[model samples]
Target: MKRLLKQSILVLAMAGMAGCTTLGPDYQPPEVDVPQQWQSSLTEASTVADREWWKLFQDPVLDELIQQALENNRDLRIAAARILEYAARVDIARAGLYPNLGYGADVARTQSSRNTLGAPPDGVGRVGSNYHAALSVGWELDFWGRIQRSTEAARANLLAEEYGRRALVLSLVSSVATAYIELLSLDRQLEIARDTLKRRAENVDLFRVQFEGGVVSELEVAQARAEYETTAILIPAIEQQISITEYNLSLLLGRNPGPVARHASIAQLVLPQVPGDIPSQVLLQRPDILQAEQDLVAANALIGVARAAYFPSISLTGLLGLASAQLSTLLEGASGIWNAGAALAGPIFSGGELDARLRVSEAVQQQLLQKYLVTIQRAFSEVDKALISSQKLREVLAASQRQVKALKDYNKYARERYDEGYVSYIEVLDAERRLFDAELEYTRRQGNSYVALVAIYRAMGGSWVDAAEAVADKVDFPPQDAPESRHWWEYPPATRPAAQNQP
Candidate 1:
């Protein structure tokens, strides 16, 4: 019997080794249609997409705010936490590849009535005490690759979570930068409004004086007062917006509503130039796209897992221990007892459950495949839109600057004409009004340009925070033979490098 058991074990081991083939289709990244060049005419230059892109703005306060949001943003923290959760799940799935061992002990007392137990001792009850201790082990051999496929799926999920975290970080950086730029723009507008109000107030006094001297009508004074009040009204509304924006930023920092620190005004901030030649293939490096691909990989692995369920599951269970009525004898050889067994379970009749599950898994894989493709396409669209927006907004900003300049000149000349009685006060008022509106619009255009640039960086999957740099304070020397450093997204197809291999 023992020899037969040994032979059986050897056969099973050989069978397990021979059946190691995985059951599902191996994962291949879906092919995508990549544009040869962007539609915009921006020159292709070394991409600033990966390196602390926000630093291009050259604002220390803005830099600090982005850093703060990265460290403290609630959504980013949640994403980071999810990475830990999926990592733990990976371990759990991997554990299935190995045996599980457990140790157990028991002490118990039992009594049986004489009538029920061999009529013991002339109708007297029988009592017994027992003690037991054992070590148990069980393992499901991956003869059909179920455990292996599950582990593969789990590992892919972990990677997806990690990529999700990266996507969140990218988004957080862009959001903080955009918010900061808007705040500065609003501040500039508020300044413009207040300054315009002061000038309008001076105009009201001038109109009143001219009326008393019979040089102007009371109607002129009334018009001047109305314009001053209009400018004054804008000040409070702008202030309200600033307060709300600050509150929103505070939430991003995981803090209660409060004031955010500011260093540079809108005029002092310069929009970063968009990097010239960007490759469209760089969209693949986007974290969200990578995350979606991982999801597809995981779904693909699940199909294998479901397919494996159609094969026999082989498991071995054994207990090695001693059992005795006396606790002291529990470890003695005379009390030793051992049992071992193997099980083979296969789907003989499951009312089509196994077949349905396989179909479900396949359907899920197909869905994820489509979603992954969509994600890639969307990423490309975003980059294209941002590229065009950046170019067009630059033109808009230039025109706005020229308009502001011309309006300023017009306002000055109109004021001089009014003083010389060469034109009506209404001309001066209209010129000033146009200049004020142009100044506000110009500031807005500047803000929009910065926002569009942020979008481009985000769409390209740029990184401001390096994983290594976060843990260390010092910079490493660059390799002497290394090619000019390029952002991850900037490498052309012939020169594109693969990411580091993961276990």
Candidate 2:
């Protein structure tokens, strides 16, 4: 006992003093090459980005669809489940701060042969049984906070996963809005196609009559015929595209292909003005950036874990619970025994394995730091690029809308001239083609602008919460009444149809 106690004290002292010099170099976060200022229209900033910007677009159907996807998306569900798993791990880590206690008991009847080395008076020898049991307690001392550092790493990783999930939520919302907007654009373009086909049909009939009376040339008739068919052909192709887009949207809603409703045509819906929030806002609100930072913190903690590896470790193993061989005697007397011992251990002549491990950990941390910086650079680039793209696309769309207007006026004059016999049918056909082309270009631009807006919102990350309390409020859902209630399938039955006014 004396020797054991002396050895225990020596190991504890060694653990306290071991590795006075750490093997690995301290870690530092890598620097990123970032522009001092944004390269786009971010000079006029606003705090409105912190709100659910999608709702700002005022498409209730769209909001509901996104809510459903958030709850029903299989990937999101999987991510949420993983968070629970990590939470369980946190419980395990926190448990390490305390000891584990266990108890045991047993009962037995025995008999032995007479020929045994030390036989009893009866031939059957060594045939005696007694009741015995004990309780044990065990815990590893975290004198260097290895377990605590490790727990911190685990917690940061959990936060990273959560941020990843929120990024997905942001993406889903943006994608649904983009698809819905494009659908509206297609609807408008289809309307234009049908209208153009109507005028071309009338021109075709007029040219046929003139050809029969020998008033217009054969070439004129052929040109009108070609124009009519060319415009007619696009209708079917566009209808096909609309179908596919609808199917794509169904998949996003976690369902099979079906029609979706909305409140406005492409022309009626208000184009969202990009709130010129500064680039600095992105640093705090972007989910990917936060996730990257969390990963950096986790990597930093791992260095501590490895650094602690160079130090001696002390531990406690004790027996302190009730146990007995006889069920009746288990708790009848103070016979249930208890025992405890403190242990101390440290690296001795590990052939430099401990030192090598520390180097590897430091190297890993350095790589993570570099990656963290690169992630930030890329995030900033995306924000700047989205900002610029949104502005440029809106300008192009405005120009295209004006071009369509001009072409429409030109078509009116050309048609009147054909009626007065000032021009041949060919001129009218040419005017129709030009106007149709202009309308199509305008519709395409409209579609592209909506998609770019979605990209901008997603690039900025999910809703930016400026306060820790906001985060807590979002995450504090009671387990039984989890946020999963907002899933698509569980939408409020009393809510109005999302797109009743706009087919």
Candidate 3:
């Protein structure tokens, strides 16, 4: 009996100390084509990135509004809450590695009627009172590493959620910047219209005196008044646009429609320089890319968890306590009791349940792999589109500047011709119309140029840093050509939570 007891103890200890082999496929990063660099006509002004893009225009008001939106944006707040929720999930997943110990106590007094078959009877004797106390522990040994894989997957999910929140933050920041630029453009347009209105008013006064002195016709005086009123009409239109844009900006800040304060002009606005970093660097900084990668990681981890299902799950459960029928003997040495159990369970027949789960996990991993590739494609597309947009807007601005200059010259010539009686009022009106349209066009393109710069910054990943070396953190994974079937053990054990990426 002593030899058998020693052998049993040896067997149990060996089972406890033996390393469980994890059965699952390894993860591979999805494949995607990314250009090494952007090709464009615009100069790469990497040094000018030191200042905020808005400050390039020297507009303090525009800067202030963007800051306010960042602080008050409700969408951003909601996204932050979601990140925290995922953080909690990560904590829950990590808890699986520890034993679950619970302390329980019970005191019961019972009385029963006369016996039926072997049942006891209250009439035979007073019902007994029982007291029981126990500390129970149950721990599923991670011999097959199912729980470890699950924990790893959860950690990846937390990271993905974090990056998702950062993506939302980036979007919010861009919206605020875009709206403020538009507001400034509108302000500039209003100023231009009012200035033109004042000049036309002067022209109207001069034309009236000329007509009264018999130097010009009533048609000339009427045309001058029409031009002045036409310019005055644009002021209100521009003002309406300003109101709408301000309200739109207020909404972006998660506020009601109200006035937004800013101090900047299109002329005063500064343009941001294009950074010269290769597009490849953006993959490391962009939040959407990281989020997609983590999603792929979680899908990969689930495969291990599913594959491990094929192996028997080893677990230990035990209870140590004192129980006594008499209240006086409950805590006495004679009432001590202890129990322990170990179980290894594997499915013999589940009608393809395990196979189905394994296949499902693989299929889902493949799906996320495609989505991951798509995200990379999207990131590339955005950068290219922004590059093309900025280049074209810059060209348009240059042309509009020339057009504005030419229109000014034409208007001056028209005024001189009218004063010398060399042209009719219709010619002067045409020149004034051209000049006004040219000025408005030039101002809009200027704002668009600034906006295009914002797009470039976003596409280039906007200065947020991250720490991830490939996907796995536990053990080093061998490099593979593709995302097909790969070896496990490539994932590292240590994980960084997503919240650490926040500013």
In every candidate, how many clashes are there? 6, 8, 11
| The 10-residue segment with the lowest total lDDT in model 3 | 466-475
- Find the 10 residues in a row with the least total lDDT in model 2: 487-496
lDDT string for model 1 (1-503, tens) is: 34544554564455446646679888988888887877767753456776788877889998888777766677765655565566567778879877777899999999877656465685454788899988777778887678888988887887787677667667777788888999999999999998889888988988888899998898899999999998998999999999999999888877889999999997888777786566677668777888899999999999999999889988887776779988888777788777778899888899999999999999999999999989988888888888889888988999999999999999999989988989988898899889998999999998898898888887777444344124111111122443466333222112235673453
Q: Residue by residue across 149-262, what tens digits does model 2's lDDT show?
A: 777777777767766666666666778788888898899889999998998899789889989999878888888888889989999998988999888888887787888777
Q: What lDDT score is found at residue 338 in candidate 3?
A: 73
lDDT of each: 0.78, 0.69, 0.73
Error of 3 at 48 (Å): 5.2
- Candidate 2 lDDT: 0.69
Candidate 3: Cα lDDT at 460:
65
Query: Which is the leading candidate under TM-score?
Result: 1
Full ranking by TM-score: 1, 3, 2
Give RMSD to native, each candidate. 6.7, 8.1, 8.2
